[model samples]
Target chain A: MSDAAATLKSLPQSGGFNNSPLAQWVKANLFPNWWSTVITLVLTYFILKFLFGALSWSLFNAVWSIEGTDTEVCRELKGIGACWALIAEKHRFILFGTYPFQEHWRPALLIVVFLVLYGLSTVRALWNYWLGVVWAAGLLSIGILMWGGVFGLRFVEQERWGGLPITLMLATFGIALAFPLGILLALGRRSDMPAIKAICVAYIELIRGVPLISLLFMASVMLPLFLPEGLTIDKLLRAQIAIILFAAAYLAEVVRGGLQAIPKGQYEAADALGLSYWKKTGFIVLPQALKIVIPPLVNTFIGLFKDTSLVLIIGIYDLLNAAKTSTIEPKWQGFSIEAYVFVSIIYFVFCFAMSKYSQKIEAELSHTHKH
Target chain B: MASIPRSRPAPPSIKLSLSDPVVRAIVFQVLVVGGVALLVWYLVSNTMANMEARKIASGFGFLNREAGFAISEHSIDYSPADSYFRALVVGVLNTLIVAILGIILATILGTIIGIGRLAKNWLISQICSVYIEVMRNLPLALQLVFWYYAVILENLPSAREAHNPLPGVFVSSRGIMVPVPANDPTYGWMLIACLIGIVGTVLLSRWAKARQAATGQQFPMLRAAAGLILGLPLLAWLAGGAPTVLDWPELRGFNFQGGGTLTPEFAALLIGLVTYTAAFVAEIVRSGILAVSHGQTEASSALGLKRGLTLRLVILPQALRVIIPPMISQYLNITKNSSLAVLIGYPDLVSIANTTLNQTGQAIEGIGIIMMVYLTVSLSIAAFGNWYNKRIALTER
Candidate 1:
């Protein structure tokens, strides 16, 4: 009875911080020791200093707006404060590049369609054959929304496409096209057939060895030469193809990791059940492998999304290019700082959301495994 | 049971039908190879037709032609009058400069930040976490432009108003200008001595390690290595009369003329790549350290090992096994990413090749050159990584 009482008494002290008061928690975490206090004090000073400087520059002393494209107000406060008037003036161009000004509603609506598709895809219950059909429908509507010639809607050539919609298209289409190709490549690399394995290895390695810019340069400049006479691909399509091919190589490696992770017994079990290679892989192997690899696939997707910005190098105006163009105008020439900051926040938001989601999923996966 | 004679089933005979796996494998390989060959033939024929129609010559002969355009920066002496090959050499060297410096700096910074992320101080860890996330989530290209436009070009004043951030270092829109050692032959001897000292230190460590295994006695190996590395170089410098003259940059007409300078383009590219890559490196490092199980540290502590010895003998070796492969890939990433120098006009290989392709209209050859150079570098690094990994791999037996 004495021993039992002693064990019970020690439980609360061992689980110390679970229901502790705020002051105790704060003292333990933030100022647990002299060194920690020193760190907290130093970090607090710098953070406050930066916050004050940034607040004054971006909010307090900023030029919010100027009437009628006037530069005098912004020019006066060039270094002293932010010229958010530039962002307000150039947000349209930055959001939707050379697309017809009157038809901005289409791209704007296209952005909404993308968001809805993303939202649908994110829900766990929707991950089924219906999801693929939904994606197909979503992609078709995306095409129609981007290029309309029927139903009293004006047709807009892809040449005029730019900005955020283009960024999304490049990233989304890249992943959509690359995922299957990556799976096939991964399967081929693991196959017993030497020729197929060699081909897959060669493709993946050649694509991955060089930087994306080199491939973009090839797609933009050399791809024309490789095509038949009188046949030309549009710049955006060419860049999109390059992105698909590049992303597939990286995705293939990730999938290969998943493939390697499967125990030999699983493959043997499927084989003993009289399943053919394709049936076994598609019905059994892939389901388990892809499930295990989703978190890493999301990481690859984050990379792909960021890589879409490189399309600007080939003069296919993506978001970064739009921002650069916004600054080229005489009115907004010196306000690229504001332009970049604005665009960076957008990019950051997308990337951060994806990374957080990926982290959460990974944590859940590890949790299940632990249990 | 004895009267029943059981006949063994014959092993499955090979058949030419699709049901036979051997036959299927052969047929599949054939079809795939044939299809690939057909595609290659078609593309080649098309390329040939297009080249003839466009009247564009396809050969490496253009490499010998005069590169009429000027490169903004070059590691070696280069002129507009130089051959295209020489210009390419300059660009390759420039790319190497960024790769080498970026790798070194990123490794140092990433290790520090990674350790900081695990600090006992909650504020320090939080600060490190924020730094990694913010640096990583933003696109590298955007960061490069910001560094070029907002930080370097816009914020820095012109040459006349160059700010002295350090004792003899100047920052301006023109680029960074800092003091350089005056032309002295003694520095060359010192550099050679430093190289020799490095080699000597390696030999000393091998000997010390063998001695420790044999005698179980510790040697002051670090002090001995340090002395060899530093003392030899210092002795060489002292023997050469210890010249300490420096050529400080001065405002001459419109620019600083006397010192070693970093072009704005190079500075932007380097800073962007190093900081961006450091975030990735930090994550890899943290994960590697975390991969070392807590039980190993406890075991070492229970064995009466000091904290430093516990970490060195138990934790680090295991952590390194997880750390090295990813760390190598990060190095590879830095090398590949240095190609982004084109965006900021750093005159790297891609930029130089782009100019060449435009000037000579040798698209196929230009692209071929780029792929070859990158492939060679990449394969070499991969090969080296495999070798190093094998050397450090655990002996299971």
Candidate 2:
């Protein structure tokens, strides 16, 4: 027993917690030095002041209900808070734009469906051939709902379809269609034939050299001129095609980066096996190259999503346009801040989720590569 | 094995021309080229027919016609009487102004934020991360609109309630009016002095480098260069009467008069572009800095170098190699995105061309001009980037 006691005395002593966890954390992280302490204090004070001011403006003094012309209430509150009642009064118009009032449910449901499809896609277990089928079916259902000509539902022109549904459809279709075209273009760029290579290079560079706004303008203006008389296409379709072509060029470059990363040994091995060219590319090469490029591919998708908002310039009533239009209501003329904030939150949520998903996929891919 | 092979090797049969891979490839190429040519021909013919039917005379001739539109912000003197070509020039200049200013501001802000992300202070780093995430995730167009309508116009006090926040500055919904120097003839001499100072600084820096190599002595090259550039210009200005006349804006009627104005549209476009692009630049910078292995810092420290010295001598040179290429692309992106200025009525090239096209029914020509301008800008930036990249690339002998 005496020997044991002596051994215990020789062990390192723990500095038994003299301070609380919060105090210790604060000392270590924020107040390690005089300058750090000052900086921390000053920054914290300003951040809190700003936060509380925003909170009070957005919450405490904000008018919540659409009762009466609540413009008076907002004027009285002045700079103290937001006028949320403006959003309340204009939410439907902001969400659906010129879509028929009673049929607002169609777009509202389409948004939920799109969200479900997005969620489904995020699940690793659902990543199979069936996923493609699901996407196709989902897109078809969304189309039928938006352009109702069957089941006794009223027929709505594409022109009448606006707001969030249009934004979702354009982005989804743009990325989906661009993917295959991008792969083809990437392949063409890497081909041995000079003619094919030149054409691909020219297309990619020309599209990438200009802004999406210019392309949209070309679609809206020049496309009609190029088409024969009586072969008119919908304006929305024209913009959608422009988006597809523009995205394909960017995506082609990204895919080319992945293809270049692949080892020449893989191609040589497949050739040695006497695999046909298409078989080799489709079965042996593409799977690995595409897997390697998933992160960048998702990044391109995020860019495409943000870019879809530019359709507003071409007079498309996308989500941002709808929100902007809502603010023009005489009753809510100056309350654009609230509407913009709401729309920004929606964009932020989608973009942040996509970025996070890409990061996660990148981490997983690298982890798998380690084995 | 050779004897066995000699037993029965019938003269190699010539492959059928139809089955030959070379022939197949040629056919495929011909088919693709022919298809593309056919499509182009079809488009041209259809366009011609459409133009004939619409009675729209198509050509570049419209460029010489008068552009009867007033541009709000122009770097050059522009009037409704100006030809469309001159109007387009003003538009291009306006685009360049925004791009140049945006590049400068974004670089400054992004570098600061990027360094802050790696700061020893946890709160500072977190704040910087949040700022980057929030700024990057939102659509730039939305941000531009919000900045124009909500942040600047709605929030600022109207002209009737204008306030002088600074000695010679006025803030109102009309715009932020600030004092500017009157155009003086002696300014040209000051500019010449500045050019001379720049040349002198370059020569001095090269001399300093040579002296350091020859004699192992350190010179304060940066301080000396700054003195030459700034002091020479100051002395020249002083010699030329100091040109101290200020054009301070005064509240006249419902507007401010007599000073340069930063219109709300310009302010909004600049802020939106800078903040959005800065987020991307911050990530590039952070990644570039991180890419320089941590061992570099430790090695410099082991050699007894101070922190700032280590960063300057060991870290930045390596980080810049990684930073520059992406930074070039960001610059190109900024130039291209400046087209979005039209959303807020900033009369950029696209906006001006759009108006011209609407007036002249020259959609094809208008779009073609816009494309050519953008392509030229893009190609120039890319060419410059490639040259710079080659100069800085690692020389692996």
Candidate 3:
């Protein structure tokens, strides 16, 4: 420490900034020797200037209240910011799509249930078998909320269930169900049995080769042809199946990568102990392999979450579709930006949080592995 | 322990039981085969019943029938009067063109950005990082919409207010206009010369490198190749002197004329697919570079090689083996995601197939064709990628 101090003391600096060594050095070397400091300041100044202007125009100088004639109200706040009145008039359609106006609370309730599930899952203490019960109960409650007929409730058709909650439900259920299917497929692919391995590989590669939109289209349009004459499937159920199948294929690959990374010695050790195949896998291999795969698995989940928006192509009014529908309303025809921005922020929040959580899990797993 | 072994040795042949390995294997095989057969039989029966009831024919022969819808863009000759088969071909070609061009552009852009993220320059690195973060976080479909509706449609100058560069080039919301070459014998010869020059330059590079290594003499390979590839082509064109005239887009009332127009949907889909895939590619490249050990760099430096030389000679060769596999997937991803063009009406293969299915009520046939096309494309890419990977892999053992 003294040697470093002596070295620092021996170094000369320009006599400026009250003769503080660091400040004098910065002023002389950073400011004078490099143009980067000057360029950075200039760029920062312009960026901040633009940001402030946009903020002022979008918020401070904006029309807040829905009052007067449309043009007149906007004119009244001429120097003010954005006309948020369009959103006020059309926010319901954006939130609930073509669901009955009075029944908007049903979808709203469903959204709350979803939020609770998401919140609970984020807490480590709550991530247990009881939480599984909570999730199952919550899902049932949401279903009842959306489609009422039990316990003196009104019956709502699947067609009427639209907007953000439906999107989240499809993605969440798809991922949950796909997780087990993916694990089975991954194990089957790695199975010593040739028939099982071939079947698993074919299923995974066939599904992964095609785009989700095509699969969704097949599910929506052509699935009925493959069903028995008397059997009929709901459109939403078919879309859910497509989502599950697609997610499972991608997730299976991620899981397979993890399984391959587990050393052969683990399997040999399990065999040496005379454990049955199922016991060996269930008690030992899967836990360690899954820990290795948390990052990629989360990524696959995020991909599926974002991909739920493709349901809109088959006329399922998901969040983006709902937003589009809202923007097309005569009262809010030109405010598509605000509606899109709102939906994008919702998606960004979910996806960003998932990735950040995945990173955290990865760090923890690596830390544990090292010791 | 010895007594138990003697009991097994007493048997003339290996015994099989329900719990034994052979019986278990046979039972499992029979069960799997039976299950698959059952599924196939069920599906076939159901499909026949549905087709009989709906009176919808289920053969690919319908492809020969006329497809009456006009396509927005085509690289080859096509018309509304053409057969569904022809229309499908046009769609497939369009998909390939976009996928190939997008892959090339994405690779170039991704490598640059990936390296820039690791550069000593702080600004460049930060800018690249920010780009990756924002793009990777956003849903590609949303980015497509933003590019289409907000950036391209809102910001592009109208035809009346078109931005022009030089005499013949014009830019508008409609499309970019540049001089298109007309048919001429002399120009054809010049193109042939250019092709020859390209091949010659490649051969000359190999020869130059070999000579430099053998004789301890440096070769000006870049300059020589540049002269052969560019100068020869230019000289051939100059000798022939077949002047090509510019055919500028003229404003005919409201719309521009005399040049090809890129539809907004196509532009949006192309940009989105390339940018989204490029982000993944950039991450792959960054990881690939990191996978090359610092010891490799130190070793090169100790051998008195410059930084650039070390990177090109030692690092990139190692990094590429890591990079290529994931990069191939990213390419495949870009190709597959181009199917999103259906949402915005870009008329890709899936869009054309949808139209075909809707018009003919041939759901099974249309879907089968679509799946087959995608399967073929995927398998070909997988095969090529594997072969390329094998070539680049280090023989460490």
Candidate 4:
């Protein structure tokens, strides 16, 4: 009886050709039924076809070098695949539109510096009071680098600044300036003071109601009309301010959500400690509220990053606009698709990374706080 | 040694003081209000001076002037000779058209994809997730540009080489021309029949519900409603001398003439807005569905309800409560994002106002109108959402 049982047990788990985990997974996930199997097969066919087509187009037929070739070479391979040659040739113009070619290294260096600062800020170990100092120093340095006059570098005007650097500048500065304003607005909205509450509500609603494009238009056009005679704000500055105002409203709402989540006990305890309103908020409430809101804050940051593109409407030469302007060249006229795709990849990388970071933070926070 | 007892401090006089919370609050409010008032005063003075110096007339009076620029797409009758106000009205209508259509399309697509995300089919779920990720990650403006330039203009054939994918329908780089129904007299009757059928469906469903409550017997309400709606419309059309003639688009030398055409700009904007907003809507829907507790489903099933009936009767209604608030915001988002139609030269409100602003140099007035319109739209959606939410909200003591 024991021998028979052993033999039966050793019969490869009963089902034919389903002994392997791969087969088991396929059966369980892909082909649990006739309908599922049919769907899997059809989807697999189309997906594979698409993957192969994309691969062949992007890799096999794509022209990689434009060093020794011209537009004619790209034209020859036009219908077959993407003209990557166009990206290679005009990448400089696309990166630093209207900026003098000799000074390309400045913007390039600034981009790297800003990226490094961003990376540093993301490290949990770097979360301290000094981080604010670091950001301030970093932003100042970037400003000096972009505007150049103090350090004996040539003065490149704001008009000449473009590409990735400008995109980063607008987004980073907008968020940096907006964060404190957002916190204030959140507090004001929740405060017992009626006048303060009303103003905060109105400001938030007004900004939230309109599209960012309208604000950009208001900044670019109406802002000039509103300013004192002969007192001017640069197009970039006005756009930046508009972005700050718009982002602050959204951030305020998020912060308010975080604030509302804080327990009444926390407030009562702070009150019992004889803490003043400002001290109570700063020490007792805001830290915990802000901590709970980090994920949403990051999401807002990602949104602000994407929205920096809207500055293109008001004639700011951000990365997207730079790419677009590059494609306007006669030699690169037909390669807009390639240029846009490249720019899109850059944006996608930044946004995806930020979103992933937010997810990770959310997971970590939840894990630590598991009941 | 025994210590001498200290005398209680004398009560302080009740006086108006900054230390008092009530007095401090009043002071703070006055200060804030004063600051705001001063800021407003400064801004107005500066604006007035700037306007005077630049010789720029400010106000709504300029809206009466001729627009002097052509709008490519307009819902209402418009010409370059039309007043700026009329041009703006057309722009608002165009904006409304795109926003409404985008909201409808996005909701449908989003709901399907949202449900698809929860499907047991692995390939389908993965595809839906991928689509959501891609559409969400990209900026709406960039996507609009892509749809306009790459998808529509570059990939589509020119008018001369228009692709006739369907009979009486022509798609080209210029636009998509689809056969529309002729302005037949019978069409009015057919539409009226549809309205009647809809009313009948509602009454039928109500009666069925009441009967079920009283008799504990189920009715095939869906089939009956569908039959009424479809059959009545068909009968009306047939009775009114079925006007089957379609105004087919005919390809002239360089373009399709006749029939309704969806301009490339409109198409691109619609597609981009729908796809982008749908990603967000899908997430909202998924979360909303998930918010309907699993116990509810188990309980419904335990009561001998089938899967379809349980989902329809138990899950969806509860899920909709969680879904709607965010869904309204998404609708508002679609409306606002439709302003990006300017990027592709769609004559949306923002685009038309932008041109008006440029031509008339009435930037303040132009921006004011745009802001007011958007605010009105946002408020209206919020108010409607609030009403619906209140209606559907779970009531408890």
Which DockQ-derived CAPRI band holds candidate 4? medium
Error of 3 at B143 (Å): 1.9
Candidate order by decreasing lDDT:
2, 1, 4, 3
Q: Compose the digit string of candidate 4's lDDT tens values, residues A1-371.
A: 85676566456776667677888776678977767889999999999999988888778988887756467877777656888887888788777777878888888889888888889988999999899898888988888888888868899988888888888989999999999999999999998889999999999999999999999998988788777777899999999999999999999999999999999999888977878889999999999999899998998998899999988898899999988787776776667788889899989999998998999999999998896
Query: CA shift at B235, candidate 3, in angstroms?
Result: 3.8
Chain A TM-score of candidate 3 vs. true chain A: 0.88
What tens digits encode model 1's per-residue C-alpha lDDT throughout B313-346?
Answer: 8999888888889898888889888998888899
Model 3 / residue B167 / CA error / Å: 6.6
Best by DockQ: 2
In model 2, pairs of residues that clash are A57-A81
Look at candidate 4 and tell me the lDDT of residue A73.
72
Model 2 interface RMSD, one decimal: 4.5
Candidate 3 RMSD computed on C-alpha atoms after optimal superposition onto the true structure: 4.5
| Candidate 1 wrongly placed segments (more than 4 Å) | A1-20, B1-15
lDDT of 3 by residue, B1-397 (tens): 1122344545577777675555676688679878988998999899899999989987788888889999988888899999999999988988887788789988988888898778554555677887787777777777776677645664567778878876767777776666566555677777888899899998988888899889978888779888987888788878878467545567898777775556677777888888887878888999999999999999999999999999899999999999999888887888888888887778789999999999999988888888889888988998899999999898887
Q: What TM value does chain B of candidate 1 have? A: 0.94
> Any residue pairs clashing in model 1, and if so which?
none
Q: Which stretches of candidate 2 lie over 4 Å from their true place?
A: A1-24, B1-19, B203-220
Q: Please provide, for model 4 over B1-397, each residue's C-alpha lDDT reduced to its tens digit, 9 standing for 90 to 100.
A: 0011114343476668786666788899999999999999999888888888889987799888888999887777889999999999999999999999999999999999998998888899999999988888888888988889877887788898998999988899989999999888788888898899999999989999999999999999989988889988899999988888889899888888989999999999999999999899999999999999999999999999999999898999999999999899899999999999899999999999999988888888899999999999999998999999999989989
lDDT of 1: 0.89
lDDT of 1 by residue, A197-254 (tens): 9999999999989999899998999788889878899999999999999999999999
Provide the RMSD of all predictions against the true structure, rounded to 1 decimal: 5.0, 5.2, 4.5, 4.9
In each prediction, how many residue pairs overlap at the backbone (N, C-alpha, C within less than 3 A)?
0, 1, 3, 0
In model 1, state the lDDT of residue A206: 93
Task: Output the TM-score of candidate 1.
Answer: 0.95
